[model samples]
Target: MAVFQAVRANQEESMRTLGQVKPWCAGILVGTVLAAGSLVPSSGFAQESVSVRAALVKGALPADDPSASAWNSTPASEFPMSPQVHWPNRIQEVTVKSVKVRALHDGQQIAVLLEYEDPSQDPDDAAGLEFMVGDKKAHFAHGQPMAQVQGGPVNIWYWKNKDNNALDMNAQGFGSLKVQDQQDVKAKGVYQNGTWKVVFSRALSTPDVEHDTQIKPGDFINIAFAIWDGKKLESGDLKEKGSQKAVSSWWYFRADPPPDYSAYYYVALAVGLAAGFQFVIIRKLKKGATS
Candidate 1:
């Protein structure tokens, strides 16, 4: 008890000098909340089930151009290429066809398999969604293609370069067999089946990590299917390079995070407190000299 008190006192004192007391306090509060086994999120880390619905829109796409892939090619990072996950323009024309979510440790997620039809009859290369597993990019394609990662592999990730009409490992497709971070969710596109299909999956863990431990039963999961016009990539484009313009899909994973620290609010509060303290000190000295 004494040691714990001493540690708490030290944490408090550190905030005073560092002008980070509030953030520290907030962090502590958040930590306590999680430790007490009371799970909830103030924002991004909130534990709840998110459902998404994306049915064909009115004249969604002309049946004549059913082969056309949505999207107009964006950076490797970001989706529809938006930083915000819930952005309106990010990915549209999507719906939660089906969702099966479970818990994995402190985090939860929704796992699903999306299917898009490739109405395009001609063979075309596909530049599917690109998700980040750490710094590495997970490119999805109609047929699996070459891969290189700046960090470690997403463990259970792989792509089949087989140029089959359907994106089957027993067929052909590229995706993150493993997921590093929810923020790492990237974008890819391809025309598959008799229409264009782009599948997206998001797995989030409260722990700040690129990937999280696997999922177990009873964990709450959130799922959404956004519809985004497939960003068209040139034949030379990465998403559409090899066998482009087929169907695209991505699989995200939840990895484990080391048990430490507090919630994001605490971190933000700590920073805010530090900033406020610095501001107060500066003004305090100025006023003191004037007085």
Candidate 2:
């Protein structure tokens, strides 16, 4: 507990000092710490799954471009879901057993293809409707118990087909979701043969946005997914009277980085040892010559 508290304190102090002095540096420091495994678990799930390498590409893939079809060949990471409940509000177990995700990246951009099974196309009806809590427009989702946290906000890219398009949401907790106006995300959804394949693409880093997580080639990030089966009438309860349910990915869907080469400390130590060994050999040769 003390160690955790100390880490929190140091992190807070560092943010306060660095954010004001150099925001870019602060962002780099935070990313470095996260990548180093000091904060979040930087590993895959205990269960075995295919590795989805965000293979480096020359440019970002286009939404309808045929060349992007190659990404479909990559191995997918399957994730299971556990039904979520909030007291009287119980969203039964997800309709699908697992979701398959494949990712591709080109140092500067990332594209993720999410595939899941759904019998019918269930599109979101309410895209612009204000989420209300009692009489007032609530900043977050109402009736969701575990939605809000001081530090854990989720970035969601939701697709409502081509008509409603995609919405970029910053969710602090269940009902407390804010739509981002200046979203950089692009998504395309295709429902055919009783399956839904959606692609989400975005810039690896958005420096001006605090809500965005800056991603690089070799950085692990937690990704969780939710599916609202439209056929089952799983729309927002406030709009549909609490019957709404979504199959949610197990607490986290871990995205592992490609080959990581950021081992400067170890590399420096090895170099020093090799130099010292060479120096010792030279000294022995000199002593031998003198003798």
Candidate 3:
């Protein structure tokens, strides 16, 4: 397209100028260009899609630590949190406006870090990740009705600030949350500087295949989120349950497969060849002027 060609021309001009200024600048530009090119959609066309990308790493992922250095390289996706207005016990006022999410995977396991601003440190506060099941559509808040769970059941990974561990739970519509027998989810939360950072981690696959969502590399999964601010008197009581928290609509989540560097190699080679050709042309032009 004309747009792509123009963008490529601009990039080439920038790179040539930088290459003449300093060799190190050209190297940095190469890296920057490569990163930008990698972000283009595989379809060769761009469209709007909201999803949390889990970067694939080589070794172990940072499980419980929210301040781990590995997270620095991982890109963050922030989703707005809104009051739950669907249920009777819904939150009319929003205490937590938004949450920043970052994720990483080590091929075998995946870890997600959630960061939010909260003035009061309520260890009683709770947060969790909810996943949809199958291709069938269900209520994003809870899930399908209990009797119709066969159509689709929601899997939840819940963690309370006061608890030392996370709970693997399931739900089918309202008032149907049940803790699973297999407690495979692990979490850790820390409060500092008027903010709460929590990290949750679990294996890619579990034995409870029927109830649990199997996460695979390069697969798009539907995910939702919920957070309860205990400072606002949100609790687990049936009378005050339902929607007394903040929730998000269904969003996509994907664990990226390992990256391929062959494109980078080819691009770098082309740039080098282009630079050599430009140098030869400039030298010949200068020689002609002198003669």
Q: Please tell me which predicted candidate would have the highest TM-score against the true structure.
A: 3
Worst 10 residues of 1 by lDDT: 71-80
Off by over 4 Å in 1: 1-111, 114-121, 127-150, 155-162, 165-194, 198-239, 242-291
Q: What is the lDDT of residue 262 in candidate 1?
A: 71
Instruction: Itemize residue pairs with steric clashes in candidate 2.
Output: 140-175, 140-176, 141-175, 141-176, 147-173, 147-174, 148-173, 237-242
Better of 1 and 3 by lDDT: 3
Task: Provide TM-scores for the models.
Answer: 0.22, 0.57, 0.69
Over 158-200, each residue of candidate 3 has an lDDT whose tens digit, in order, gives 8888785699988877788899988888999888898888899
Instruction: Please estimate how well model 1 matches the true structure, expressed as its whole-model Cα lDDT.
Output: 0.33
Give the range where candidate 3 is weakest over 10 consecutive residues by summed lDDT: 232-241
Instruction: Give a tens-digit lDDT track for model 2, residues 1-291.
Output: 999999989878965654433444435545765776676656766434433455666555544431367676556777664454543467656565667777767666777777777676755421111111112112223323443523345566666653545676666556566778777777777777877777777777786345554565554444555555654344543221222434443232323355556798789998897667557655654554455
The residue-by-residue lDDT of candidate 1 on 1-291, one tens digit each, is 999999999888876655544555556656765775755535562222232112112222221221234211111111122121231223323222222222112233322223333323333323223323244443333223445533332222222223422221111233433333333222223445444433332344335343432233332222112222233347643322222222224433233344446788798998898678667655654554455
Question: lDDT of candidate 2?
Answer: 0.55
